[model samples]
Target: MFKVKVYVTLRESVLDPQGNAVKGSLNSLSYTEVQDVRIGKYMELILEKSDREVEETVKEMCEKLLVNTVIEDYRYEIEEVVAQ
Candidate 1:
């Protein structure tokens, strides 16, 4: 078994409206020190062991469905499931 952690976020060159809204609210609430705010998505997946490489499978999933490559970038971590 394995556990996968995926993180997806807008590219630096892209605009993030939600992040901007949060930043604006923080500034309004006297949080001027907050210069920038960016929001992202975190996901987890559990799967049975397979003969195929987990890293390659996960990368394909991210590129095809989990992330929008045009305006977003993604990264992931994989951890082995230890038996209790």
Candidate 2:
């Protein structure tokens, strides 16, 4: 079995209003050190195959269909799991 962790985030050129709101709230709460917060999405995918080739293929599928590469960046990590 294989596990894939995907993180999708907006590019630096894009403005994140939600992130800015969170940062503002943090500042109001006296957390002055927090600055420039960015919001993103996280996803975990479980793949039934263990082959490295299959894993690469799955990663490509995610990049092409699941994520929008024009305005967002995505990264994924694959891990092998022991059978139960």
- What are the clashing pairs of model 1? none
Q: How many steric clashes between backbone atoms does each model show?
A: 0, 0
For model 2, give the 10-residue run with minimal summed lDDT: 50-59
Cα lDDT tens digits, model 2, 1-84, are 887888899999988999999999999999999978999999887778748576677768877788888888888888888768
Overlapping backbone residue pairs in candidate 2 total 0
Error of 2 at 47 (Å): 0.3
For candidate 2, the per-residue lDDT at 3 reads: 78
Q: Model 1 scores what on Cα lDDT?
A: 0.92
In order, what lDDT does every prediction score?
0.92, 0.85
Instruction: Give lDDT tens digits, candidate 1, residues 1-84.
Output: 889999999999999999999999999999999999999999999867672788889999999999999999999989989756
Model 2 residue 17 CA deviation (Å) reads: 0.8
User: Which residues of candidate 2, in runs, are more than 4 Å off?
Assistant: none
**TM-scores of all candidate predictions against the true structure:** 0.91, 0.87
Note the residue pairs that clash in candidate 2: none
